[model samples]
Target: MDHISREVDRTQELAGVMSKIEMNHRAFCFANVKDAKFPLVGGLYNSLERFGDALGHNGPEPFTHADFDGRIEAAKAEPIQPLTVDSGLTKENVITGDAINLHDLPVPTFFELDSGPFITGAIGVTRDPGSGELNIGIYRTLIIDRNHFVINASSMSDLRRIYSSWEATGETMPIAIALGVPPAMLIGGSCKLPPNMCEFGVAGALAGEPIQLVKCEDSDLLAPADAEIVIEGTVNFSNRVENLLGEFAGQYGPEDAPVTQVNTITHRNDAMFYSIVAGRHPEHNTLGNVAVYGVQRSIAASIREVAPEVIDLEVLLEPAMGTLAHVVVSIDKHSDAQPRDIIERIFAASGNIFPVSKITKRIIVVDDDIDVHDPVDVRWAVWNRAATETKFMVIPGIESWELERAAKAGQKSVRIGIDATMDLEDIDKLLRPIIPGIDEINLEDYLD
Candidate 1:
């Protein structure tokens, strides 16, 4: 990680530096944040290698199908431990009441059109009012003032449901936002886990140990004890504000959320305020890929249930598509109609973690020979192997992702399915060109 000593503004200047860092897929620290007490860190999870390194996997694949299943199993095996009140989170300072000012923390306004500076990296901690279950998730928080902000929780998020339950009680919900938590914790928090599963437990599974938690100063909710900064707050459903922040889909997402009142701010003596550069950046997209842990696997399982011949699946996080993911499935095709059957079943399958019909808009089915992970090969199969008349299928009026910009009224959108596999009659003719000993050849040895 490189450290830039030059003082930077909390406005677009900080975000500008972050953009430059992201362009090179590098991690950076703004050592001197103008008008703030601490430095700002960005691009920590900017690449798959970096993200994988954080989780102790030193290779290209950060999250694999096996890893996803392991994480699910680990969460079931290890439950969240009880909270420990004493930790390094408040080693030096704990500001309360008038002393708590969010502006002093170097929160960055990543885009010019943003509603205000947003805390993009913090994990929100809340408790289920009825079940007494704890939940942790990453939600963009728009800073309203020195002591207030609005948390944007999506409709499908557990936090939103918890918010609704709290609202029904006509009481303020105690919430805590933790910044600079462990990488595993951050990844786990981003996953859309089952209602009864604890995110801390999932994080522990990823870390191969229990995650230490500390009780919040003003709330019963627990946050990572090793967090760099913690903001304790309470929110009521009375006030709602509509805001905007650039999202991972490379577009500005509209947000309508409840305003939260900050009660206390705690941090270490020398703290680095972490911020994920909002919108279409490497870190934003890489971190957002944590959805593969929950949604992608669920979709794959649903597809397998309907099409047992399916061999591989890849739910691509195309940055420009927002939440409408593009899916690629490779199948062991015995008949030409199998591809269409697989595609239709996938689009209609009722997903577990998320609705497959709502999230997936485009699906492509290729033969077992095709590499589902390779975009070029998938495109080649789509163009070269698929027939014009019957290979393409479009079903109108399907459910759309809520954040989809192109969706019609009533949140409706069209579903497209492509049978990129070769026709059963032309399978021999459509076989890909392959060179003998291509994998065994060492061009570098001969050239040198």
Candidate 2:
């Protein structure tokens, strides 16, 4: 829920944050866990591997396995499983009498640097008190008092706009938050949907069926059919220092963001709470790569010429740096023309990636053959394929994910760019000399 935090009220969103303390990123379904050799702690860890199946480049079973088809597919594969009841958790629908309370749930403290333990993946559906137009944003909520939280939202976000309008009059905006909608709904909440597009509707489209939602308690807003939990609240932007917490970005964000007062909380009888590992993406946060993969087709189209060889893009969440920082590119540069230009273009092309990468020196670009999704593979390319003189280039500083001094002024850095292609001078000769026995082995069988 790094992309949006109100959705944090749900089970999966909570799972992303709680996974940190728990250190478990397994999927909701057993099949995903059953098939892969390695366990997945976060959602959509590697876009390249999953993208292969999504685009018909691979088989449909893997797509289903990776949940590329999303919530509807998940439901189809496993069917509707009901949540039970509990004082802390529940199975009650949003519209029911049980749909009340902004407390009683174990919301997570997602990051070390956060001002407080913040709820990572909650989808807040707030209505413009005056206009009454519904706006859905995935915003992070930091619990300050049982009644309030600090919402980290940008001026560009719908929540910010709607809440700001309320703050102009010293009034609070009404909000509804839901947890554990279909995975597609969470992705949609994080996605750059069209203006006035109901994320719930987009979620349904992604699922290949209309998402079943129930009316939220004490509000006109609606939540998912099988939501594990839901929260309702109001916020006054004028409230200061409400939640002066650290954030997923591994730095202290200004508590001046705004304050949210949660009045009521509700959930299914036996609701399942979720937690996400806050700080990273490759192996930590899901928001960056989720968005990267979420928008790859769009990004691919946007920078087609600038980054043509980029058959894929993956956001490697650096554990040291939180989400939004340290994005690695797997470029398929066919020409000698400045591939750095592609990196520069893509650095700007991505939506949330720009600001975090500003301080960083380089957007490391490895060849398509190198699995950008794998740190070991990318590291290997940096050693062998990278020529300090020929492979890397410098670019002026902009907002970057570089944890170092890249974003700071006078901190120009030569971004290392590797033209790791077969196009390189007889690079194939240098390839790991495959011995007969080792090369002949069926690695896929072993992988299975």
Best by lDDT: 1
Please give, for residues 45-124, the per-residue lDDT of candidate 1 as tens digits: 88766766777876555656456446555655765553465765554578997888898888999898999999999999
TM-score of 1: 0.90
Instruction: Give the poorly placed runs of model 1, Cα more than 4 Å off.
Output: 57-76, 79-83, 320-322, 332-336, 433-448
TM-score of each: 0.90, 0.60
Residues 1-448 of candidate 2 have per-residue lDDT tens digits of: 2232232432344444434433333232211221112112234333434333333344444443245525333333432322222223222433333433334445545444456556665677776666565566677677775566776765336666666677787764667777655555665566554455455655555555666665555666665657666777766656666444444455544435666666566666655554344544332344444444433434334445456666665543343543333446776555655465666676555443233234233356766667777878777877776654656554443443323422455543333334443335646665765466875788788884
Instruction: Quantify all predictions' global Cα lDDT against the true fold.
Output: 0.83, 0.51
Off by over 4 Å in 2: 1-61, 64-103, 110-113, 128-133, 154-157, 164-172, 242-255, 281-288, 307-391, 401-406, 409-448
